[model samples]
Target chain A: MNRKTLHVVFNSLFGIGGFCNAILFPIVLETQPDSLAQLLKAPVNFLRQRLWWLWPASFLLAALAKFADKKICDRWGHDAVKEMLEILREKGFPGNKEPVHFHRVTLFKHKRWWLCWRFWPWSGWLVPVVRSGHTTLNHQTCFLAPDEADHAEGIAGRCWSTKAVILIPTEDSNMTLPLLNPEVNAKPHDPHAMAEIYAKETFMDTDWVLKKLPHSRSFLGIPVVVQGQPWGVIVVDSRATKIQCAKGILASYEEIARPFIKCLERLS
Target chain B: MTTAPWIQVEPSLRMRSEPRQGLQLTLFVPPHEVPQAVRGEFDKQLKKFVIEIRYLDDEDFKRETMDDTVCLRIGKNSRRLLGIELDTANLNVAQVQFQLKEVEEEIKRAVTKFLQKDQAQEERENYALAIKAIESKGEQLLNRSILAPAL
Candidate 1:
């Protein structure tokens, strides 16, 4: 059945079960006498009584109703996201005309320290859930610290801010030159140069202020927005600097990010 | 066990000579600002770190001293460790790791600021040198045309 019809049937069953428990069960229990003999007799009377079956029937219905609830949640958990994407194609998503696409879509939840990502065909299984809050700074897998501002693995964490992006302090004039222009920092520059600069600089400053992660030398980060407000960032990094410089990487990152935002919106 | 990098320095002769010796780092709290009890309580929360408050007078005032200041000294107990006196004020253990992190950030900021200032100065010097070269070349060209061969 369609979602709307299923929703209606579930609500009606729940309402009838709630009314029976709240009104009928109490009236029947209270009318029974205090004496043991009368209590023993009560059961026989209930068997003959007009509304005696209603109490047990209500409980049975409530159980069935709960089962339906779980079933709907499990079914919608996967399909709702797919349906939302189809809707985005027809009606358009908040501001963007097209969806974002990166290697995998990541969702950084609000208020919670954990972020989750589920790949296609993987369903709910084996999604890498990154918990930055519980992670120690020097831990082998701990790349992002809880307190640190957002940054792609390749670029120095200090480079970009909501206000401005500073020049990477390196011997390479090319990297520093591009960042000096405020406009270039806001938008991605020549893909090849950015990839090369980020990779070399990350390697150069391995022990420095940069938050270094393995095989994440070439990187791009785009803000994942929800309802015009900044929710979290979608960061894509690559070990291969040469591959990152190829055209369309930035657009792909944006495309992958869009539906992921829609999924967060639906789940929240 | 190897000593942490932050504890590399030896205590100054003055500190070593002191009767009551322990590891100590003093924080400069401006005069009449933070109460001695509050400072003591903060130190107590650190558990292993002991807190001592010293009221500063004119004689005690050094170039580094701020007005209305008290110093908090954190150190290893003399009874616990024989004679490995630490000269450094900053704690380096995992318990005080955040403080070490702050020190790292402070160093990075100082270095970045120094480099930026140095770059600006170099840019100014290069601009001046370029102007001087252009002026000299123009002068030589004029001199050759007016006083020597025009060819």
Candidate 2:
């Protein structure tokens, strides 16, 4: 279970345990030999002798309860994301022609190089926990997959850092040599060299998203927040760049993310 | 055919696809900006490297390049510009290629600014910076590089 859920369960147990002991203290004192020392001594002896098993039992029950809640919330949270993606689909991801995928990306520390004995050394990735599209890879596997953007890399990471919506093709490339231009044949020059140069110029700087489906031109990443801290981002991608690049469209995508905040807090 | 022994001397040349020390090399951002992605890729296929640019001017930047070496400057007025340069002493010009996507984007931005309603003065200058980024870089690449006389 995540820290927030564990915190709530522990706090509840503490409150209940304290309240019960406080109320029962005076009643128990009246029944016992009437002294502060006697009151403390009686329960200690009784608990040690008769109810020793309850302490371990209570802890076992709390862990089991947390395990169950995690399953239920994970299902519920994914369903919420699926629903939001449907809404985004109907809206055509604000403005685009082809399929636009929506994914719930969360940050988690995973093991790095298990061969080395130093432990998973401070590696974190913003991975897709749940996704909306023609789902191919299992969500759980994607969690451990290397393709997930490192917290310090990719469009998802940038959104988490900037705390603002990021739209790609952020600026223009200014060089236009025939050698650099793909259309203008830099023939007599090597074909391999020509393609590499064009690709360098074409590859977008803002996105580090993996398995980027072809024709997915525009990328929109919104920071998915939980418990007042930035948790991850919801990535939305589409084929059209111009329409999806507007402010109104970006704001609309941000609105879609609001409904799922509750679900995020509960599951992860 | 019988070869002359005196003409049999082999050329000692080591060529590498120039690593893009271009805008793609910034540690804070991803490559296509820095050629680390392209750097790891060099061993995979025997492809030419993105030319590395060493700008003659540290600030604002006067830039130069040649046929064997291609140099193009990248970035906005306030941002640090990355220039492209190639090593041509070894590899035939058969392999070198220059990246142009940023140049295309700049052109698009310039056109957009030209069409916008609020741009007679400052926008005109903004439009010009975008154009000059394309023009000067293109002009540098267009003119063939002149090497100084080897004494």
Candidate 3:
């Protein structure tokens, strides 16, 4: 379960205990005021009464605090993802006129809990891009946002909930193409074949391009480099048919991927 | 291909580049004196580097001036383009130097700033959440305090 849900469950359980204690403590004080006076003094009855109620009240308050925290986290998490998606919408695809849809988005940590939010129209994914060597998300991830550390663990988690094809552009010389046709071990030196592999790996159906079409698919991946070392990749999925993916689009995507990458880069 | 390299002059400047083809340099000079100063520095600095120096002057400034300024151009084959402007009319030596330093520092700040910009909307929402959480807790505590009996 996600942290927000786990927190809510824990808070509810604690709230029940708190409610019982709050109700019981006052009754116990009212009934056993005289017995309690024998232990201390009748003049100190007020103190005793307060002591009896404070424990439960404090517990109840704690439960309330936890509940509020969960609510805030839920809202913030949703808004964060929404804002990112909106940016993509406004920016649109770099060069392709075809409308881009976010199929699936997720936020997950290697060892810690994972939170996945699924949207119907277009899948939006938000994942914690951890550093190259680190296995767990921690307080450092909080640096990415202002109040991310307010929680007990000091870090939030997210995951994508969609299945979409990612377009990989072939222009960037630095790009190391992912193996598309596993059957063909040989790297297709032919640009046409490479484009076909990209199309096949990305699109579920080949009907989009029946034959090996020129510039049918473009591959876009943001390199998350930390300390001059390549760490991870943030892949962009687009299905623009007319315009080919260009440098400007790549640059814009780089701008979007930067924040998450830096946050992960800073994590120890 | 035939345009002469633009040269500019300003107070207290430094230029450096490696040997390459098609490099463009645009320089901005002060009203009058700044151009001479920039030209002097460019000549000295040019000897140290393999870059071609272009001096941008009065007429170029008139034609291309977005506002009230002049720009110089210099380069070979036009591979690299650098635009330099002089704001000596409003900026002093110290201010100009500070600005140059600021630009260098901006490169570093850009790393964080770009990240912040990337998640600016998200951060704003997160801030709202944090404020709400704090406010709710505060209100609850205040209510309890008010309901409590006198000390």
Candidate 4:
């Protein structure tokens, strides 16, 4: 059986066993202390006393399954993105001077009640579930890895919020990529125009999107939609800038969303 | 009719639908301009030709339908022409090739109409480049079915 089916079976069995034990185990030990003593004498219960650890261990397995699911999603996302990049190159996509990097910044909504204990908010953060690495760049330096973007911040977040494609180019050079609070405003499409461009989103800066790697001056974020809801943004970053404005190259990479969502639903 | 070196068009089969074997006609421009494609079932090519001049969000520009299939994207604030959306679903793109010249003329006319609305320097330049791209690539789309390769 599939892992999911196995998990469901295990859960149902565990639920029934736990319910029976919740009442029977305590009652049996209370009325017949000798039975409890005999059970404790078993070799398996040597360290765990009454062997109550089994209950918590079962729950631990379920938690681990969740963590594993995230890892699996990441692995799948990475493969799909890499394959997509390859397709673009083969199809003669007019790309950038520097190697272009694409990331799937998914909105991970912490829906489960158990997830409340996590540091994440109920609304969830726009985390880079699938990240790509290159020779000149490291995955950690991207706005993902260590710190994810808030649902209302950055080009990716804004795309999610507006459900639109947000393109911030370098040749026009508007954003500061500010690591700090909002600062600077410029005319039309200058470095300071971030204030006007990001009038709704206060954190419209990216000076430190790459703390260690080379700066990503141009950004094109496309909102990924599935079943009429916003899922995430396909973030394309170019080191040489001008991915959109003033030539350099305007690619039709927007269709990457097609293969992306396809892989998501395929169960592959 | 040729595009400037700065503005380029690299045509690629950006998306192929499921079902493995079916005819899909994409009189396509390279897939730039829009942020993404709304995933849907397109058994036959959507019978549309979309040339997104600038990549834009839905709110960035307001789409004004010139006709049932022909539409122009106008910037929300600048009011300049942004792009063209033509629904060619019923139109046949085949080897017989009778409609190529007519289709090209219609496209040129539509673009000219959009450019005439605004005479700004930026609009003028955009008009030139867009025409060049259409002229250069419109022929490749003219005589053959975009799905010829698959066939």
- The whole-model lDDT of each prediction reads 0.32, 0.38, 0.32, 0.43
**RMSD (Cα, Å) of model 4:** 15.2
Per-residue alpha-carbon lDDT of model 4 for A49-148, expressed as tens digits?
Answer: 5537655654565555555555453355557765664544333324324344432222222121213222344444455544444433322222221133
Per-residue error (Å), model 2, residue B110: 38
List chain A TM-scores, every candidate, in order. 0.38, 0.50, 0.36, 0.45
Model 2 iRMS (Å) reads 17.3
True-structure RMSD for candidate 3: 22.3
The TM-score ranking, best first, is 2, 4, 1, 3
How far residue B148's Cα lies from its native spot in candidate 4, in Å, is: 35
DockQ of 4: 0.03
Q: Write candidate 3's Cα lDDT for B1-151 as tens digits.
A: 1122323222123111121111111111111111111111112222211111222211121111222222223122211112223223322224212343432233223323433544533422222322222222332222222111211
Can you give the TM-score per candidate against the true fold? Answer: 0.30, 0.37, 0.29, 0.36
Q: Output the better candidate (3/4) by DockQ.
A: 4
The positional error of residue A125 in candidate 4, measured at the CA in angstroms, is 4.3
What 10-residue stretch in candidate 2 chain A is worst by lDDT?
A204-213
Compared with the true structure, what per-residue lDDT tens digits does model 2 show for residues A1-268? 7646765776676555554445443354344433448647767556545434655555565565556556653466677766765565555443434434432222222223222221232344445655665555343322221323333444455555544445444323233322322344345565455444433433322121222313344455555444334466655554443223333333344445445555656555
lDDT of 2 at A244: 34
Worst ten in a row by lDDT for model 3 chain A:
A154-163
lDDT of 4 at B105: 65
Q: Is candidate 1 or candidate 2 better by lDDT?
A: 2
Native contacts present in candidate 3, fraction: 0.00
- Residue-pair clashes per candidate, as listed? 13, 17, 40, 11
